[model samples]
Target: MKLSPTFLSRIPALFLSCCLLLAFGCSDSQDAVEPTLDMDSKANNKSANMMKEYWVEINPLNHSGVTGQAKLVVEGNVLTVEVWAEGLEAGMPHPQHIHGFVENKGNATCPPPSADVNGDGLIDLGEGVPFYGPVLVSLTPFPTAEDGTIHYKQTFMLGMGDMIAYQALKPLQNRVIVLHGMTVEGTYWPTLPIACGQIMPGNSMGMGNR
Candidate 1:
């Protein structure tokens, strides 16, 4: 038997392809055996149950006269986020954010009533943010109702940059959501956090509570 130069050259390429395929297969096999998102584990990072819900109701801090709730839910590959409130300044655009856990050590808690250490009034956003780290996602604003009710809704992708935040959210027994008032001098109150919510597993809170 005589082997051609071309056949000899092809042998190396073929061998490399087989090796690469074998490596890929081994990696995938290992990954397949691993667990997926754990919905109940505080240590896990992701959860997917179609309509599984997690949210929190935030009381008025800083005496801004605002109260509302933030809800995070999964419908598909996107997370349906909603922040709704009443008692906020009418026609005001509030800046809201999904704050991370405090240093990723544990769940972020809403500042206790005693957090108002100054004895002036309420617990403002500045004082509250430290407990909840930076914004994970700043949602787009929806129109505020004429009656002083503000609503913000946004859907975030669960497969990209948002995936990191979405995954981290599952472990948090507490979620810190902040809404920044428009200006220093609001229609009724000064520019501050009109409303904030400490979200967890639950249904959307009705306006009656705000």
Candidate 2:
């Protein structure tokens, strides 16, 4: 059947209306999806900001000639520690530790030669404690320097006490890393501080600015 001219003329307008409706529907769907994508991006940025890294440059303390570097990474409640050193007492066990002052009592620091209160010519653990504070984390079974060198790495999950100690380390500038043990001939020699370093903030790998 042949359609009337009036009806045929209205058909084009009907088709245009349908096209406009479809276009608007697609735009609304896209608008709804955009916010979800934006939310995901924000979440990712927040996560990246939560992670931090720090470093220390261990230097000889008792003229032992020991030197090393240490890296500390904190992600959530987990911590990773890495230390590399040379010029230690060969084949001897070195007790390494992170030392800090609790509750901001005082600034953590490496003991100077003047710390030898007894005038013993070497800084023992007791003498060094005043400068570096008490041990917060012990990096032990202790690493034995096979050839006057040590390479160590370990990860730890912070417990209540550990987390408290860790919290005190915020703005970690003064926290110290102490490596003990040298070839000196004395009963306290093994506990004597051979090298020390202060922790400082470090650049996060590929995580800065999210």
Top TM-score hit: 2
Candidate 2: segments with Cα more than 4 A from true spot: 1-49, 160-165, 186-188, 203-210
Model 1 deviation from the true structure expressed as Cα RMSD, one decimal place = 18.5
Candidate 2 lDDT by residue in tens digits, 1-210 = 122355335444532332343244233323323222132577645643587888888899989899988888877546788888999988666778777665454679999899999998988777887898766666655787788899989876543332332344445676788998776664324566899998888843442221
Q: By summed lDDT, which 10 consecutive residues of candidate 1 come out lowest?
A: 25-34
TM-score of 1: 0.60
Candidate 1 lDDT at 5 equals: 56
Q: Residue 56's C-alpha lDDT in candidate 1?
A: 72
Per-residue C-alpha lDDT of model 1 across residues 1-210, encoded as one tens digit per residue: 123355336344532332343244233333333244455675343334346777677677656677777677765446788777778666544456555552343666656667666766656544655665545544544343457786667777743432333344444455577665533442322224555676677665653353
Clash number for candidate 1: 8
Candidate 1 deviant stretches above 4 angstroms: 1-50, 75-77, 102-105, 113-122, 142-147, 159-163, 182-191, 204-210
TM-scores, all models, native as reference: 0.60, 0.69
Candidate 1 yields a Cα-based lDDT of 0.54
